[model samples]
Target: GGLSNLLFKCALPEHILSVGDEPRQVLLRVYGAILQVSASGAGIPPDWQPPPRPAAPEQLQGSGLCRHLPPGPGLAAAPRLLRPQGVDSLVLESVMFAILAERALGPRLYGVFPQGRLEQYIPSRRLRTEDLRDPDISKEIAVKMSRFHGMVMPFNKEPKWLFGTMEWYLKQILELTFPEEEQLKKFNHLKTYNLQEEMKSLRELLESTPSPVVFCHNDVQEGNILLLAGHEASSSDKLMLIDFEYSSYNYRGFDIGNHFCEWVYNYTHDSWPFFKASAENYPSRQQQLHFIRHYLSEDSGRRGDTTHEEQARIEEEMLTEINRFALASHFFWGLWSILQAKISTIKFGYL
Candidate 1:
């Protein structure tokens, strides 16, 4: 059957189909190409094909009660679908994180497939960069993040991608041979800042202020945060985090720091300078304190009744840690961009 027929069988509404008009084709074009390249690299036969689509859609079992309905006719059921991306290990990690996160605090994972997995399609507005600065929204994000960190799931395998640490990413970047002098010159500009010494300083600070390890949504940028439509501003379930591909156990400060760093870059443009960062965009000291308060309040059970001074002291310490971890975020993504500049076909200023 054709893609349209498949959507009809799933009972998806016509209006829903009109939006994201070419979702399936886009998914196939992007992930399909990546899968083919991955298969070729793995020595798979040239004639190999992607896993066949299931005869029937599978409904998600035991998904928690829906807090708010979609704008159109409420979906009768959320079906699991194939995700045509990544190798076996990567696929497994993605499924594992999705399942664990769903059960805990993130998006609900419906089912797993060989190449792709199924997820509950949430109809919500993707947060704008300005929204991150909103105190109410930022507090909701902090609560959700704190809840995610508190989850204790069992997964023994190490993650294939680790954005919290700088070593692996830096190694990958250093190994790449830039094809043009311009690229080399951009890299040299990065080197002039004495990033190696900065890396050492970051490591020392992290070691000095050791944070408790927890499951982290390593990529908590504005794009990943969704504000549910038709929900009151004060609703606790108003915000939901998506895309767990980079989710893993890491330092708590790194997750918070990475999110703050994300606020500086705008990735909406489709040009050479796809993203621009500015120091003026970083969260101010007062804003950081407000965010940290919400974060620490989630674990109030352990703190017992505390004086205002005690709470203020706690916030001060967390702010210091978050400030230090901000450096690690810069180092991690700086190396990632350098490596992507070499391998990625998509046009963007990775340097």
Candidate 2:
């Protein structure tokens, strides 16, 4: 309870949402999900139960984090999604704008802005480390992908922000924490060489397409997604993707590639029961082929052109990226997690 991070719950018109604060304050980041908290409020919206009002202004000040954001009189968190940003405060701002704006086009987004109701945090319910997996999530994911790509304007900038720029940042995180200079050296070399070649190939790949970029959510972890379903009996469902801190202008393939890799990894890492609950027998290696085929079909230019050598080449490259990403996964996580573990140990000693 004494930890720096604080959680706040905000109320939107369509849904009751939750947000989190950074340790202490300053760059106050809001989580775009539901959480559990207890507080009281007034002037609350009718849709959701309004939180209790703050007894004093000092409590509402909230460690004086972001002066721009509205204060919650008193707020209690409810059970909702909680997705944190990996980057700094500035990046978090951009991410929120890009994502919330894109969602504004559809009613499903549920407004998150200066417009939300009086908010507060109550501790009645606590958000779990993870959420229960949903069955129709994939179909919902596809539609959300389409919606995001459909909304938002393209990014045009000089010097260019390459697809893996975020990965580069993550690599920096890895290097900072990674021990064993040899491991660092090997990864740096591998990344440096692959990045150069990948950038070159990516540039060429983009040359053939004149499509404008959409506000891209570079990371689509399940924690960052919210489902909007009309009813249990109805087939209707839509998803709102949150956490755009790494929002950037790049090839749509980059986003697709990451999400594709995510699914592959998600299915694999899940326990057998977790895997089955998500539906279907676990994806066999051959099922990956069908997934790839489905992915390629999204390329409008490559449609009905299975025989086209150029398209074939692109598909091959995508497959290659997947394999490379898979292999690099351990390298990245190992580096970051290792540093965190080591630092944590040194700071407090073995718990």
Candidate 3:
């Protein structure tokens, strides 16, 4: 369900279940696409071919780009999640997972290692892009997100996660050297955009909007959401959010706005590039209001037992904040893809 990691479903031996509390099955995640391929040192299969480069930058910007490519063998390797130094990223991630599990906001963590983890395997299926538009499902997601944002985490809460990570990725993009003619051509195209200036402007725009800092899932696209099997669509527990590797304390608007941008993308395409973006499918204002209403209802911190008029004003301000932060989502992922293109040996067309 993710482009950056490889997941495997593992079943425990029959005799092990006698312990009673042991999970019968677990999900194994091997982090870093290229690492998944090289862990065994065999590298990518010789017959596999790299996908074609993406279309013009203008076209991609007009319509978003999504990496929904199916998992494939990879060749090269690179560092995993970008994080601030001093603290160990893997240890910090494990702590976050443990906390979420204790709070019932995410899957239970079974085991953690240098390069991957074992997690509780929820019996569920991923929600598709269109499922986000479902009235009941959208409302439930809003409620869960409200709770997610309310969580008091131990991580730094200065709201620097988005900007810092994006700046790091930008540095990687700028420092990359593509000596191959074709690769250089792609690099040249990327050079046309002043990414540094774009980042500065985006930061200023989002700061002016003033969204609250809170714990965020960071990546809430359909692939990361699972609808538990046997639960009715109206059930409160129907949906679960997974893949918190990128989770951090950040602006609330970035989380919600990034999710809204996902409404226009379908990542399940089976062909080369393996994603489709229909800008027209972006949610209408009415739809946005519906989601916001449910979110505000559950968010006591924001709603604050205020009068209806006060709540209405809050909602109106949030609508503007969310839409503006959507641009930051674009900038964040755009830099990510560029770096992945240079270092990841995964077969997807990151460019």
Candidate 4:
């Protein structure tokens, strides 16, 4: 049902269920892509084990939740070693963010592994496509997004992660050679677009528009949002955002605008194309303003200090910013879905 990762619900055995402080249940996420190829086989072979996790000195050094938070007592004395040979940089980076997320913002983490980690299994339901348009839910999301944007990460503040990844995806798409006749037929539709030219045009277009850089939860669709058990959508803190696989420092408008585009996508479709996207369902101007207002009001200090004229100017600029960056969101996923069609094992029709 998901791309990139596999999730499993693990329950503690009866004997140990109540013993110690370990969680009774944990969510296991097996990382994607890089974990597929091994020296001995194409995928994870039986009897494989994760390398030992780093400790102490390897503690996360960054912004966001980890900025003021102290290292948990669990991070006690342990041996440290150089980065292992097989582990890629992306996996290591995600592991660091996952650890930081659990400490202050996300669900509590139980264990970390080379491929994935054990996280607290929250009893919740994912928000549906329709839920993203609800005024109350929309306001809450804006507030949370503002909070996320306020923090700075250790990475370069420039929005390189956006165009860099798009460039990589475009390169992969352009290099595909489809040698087999059957493979050529299967992917012939890809010839319709000049992805290289399209990407150049898109990068230039986005570069001309101005937006602030921030640490963004790049994927903020309905499926990634959770409504905790016993809490209704109306509750102030009921919603929680999960999945930081694509999280990075990027343009602020891309984060907000991408979410607006998600209001039309229903990923639960049961047939070909595998999802439904209706452009007519895009948020109205009033709805966008409502969300932007909450986003700006999130920081009480900033909100209280701004004069009415300055607030109006800021709001108008953000409105324009959000609209322009929506194009970036479209260009990004168009390239991303094409690459996913080639590499991903997931059944969804990413193309």
Candidate that scores best on TM-score: 3
As a whole number from 0 to 100, the lDDT of residue 182 in candidate 2 is 57
Candidate 2 C-alpha lDDT tens digits along 233-287 = 2353444554454455554555654554454333222443222223243333454
TM-score of each: 0.73, 0.45, 0.83, 0.80
Clashing pairs in 1: 83-116
lDDT of 4 by residue, 68-185 (tens): 1121211111111111123554554566456556546567767777766767778887788998988999999998888888875666676787887776556556666444475466
Pairs that clash in candidate 4: none
RMSD of 3: 9.6
RMSD from true fold, candidate 2: 13.3
- Lowest summed lDDT across 10 adjacent residues in model 2 is found at 37-46
Question: Tens digits of per-residue lDDT for model 1 on 1-351?
Answer: 111112211223334443354232111001223343343323223233334433442432232221222112322211111122225545656666566655755555545555454455555767877889999998988988888888765653343233323554454444455657998888878767876677777678778986667888888987778788889988877988866655777888889999999878877555658667777889999888888888888878755878999988878888888887888788777766665565444456767
lDDT by residue (tens digit), candidate 3, 29-62: 6665444333343323433333432221221122
Q: Candidates sorted by TM-score, descending order?
A: 3, 4, 1, 2
On the 0 to 100 scale, the lDDT of residue 112 in model 4 is: 76
* Superposed Cα deviation of residue 78, candidate 2 (Å): 16
Query: On a 0 to 100 scale, what is the lDDT of residue 47 in model 3?
Result: 33
Worst lDDT run of 10 residues, candidate 3, spans 53-62
Off by over 4 Å in 1: 1-92, 101-104, 156-165, 191-197
The numbered model that scores best in lDDT is: 3
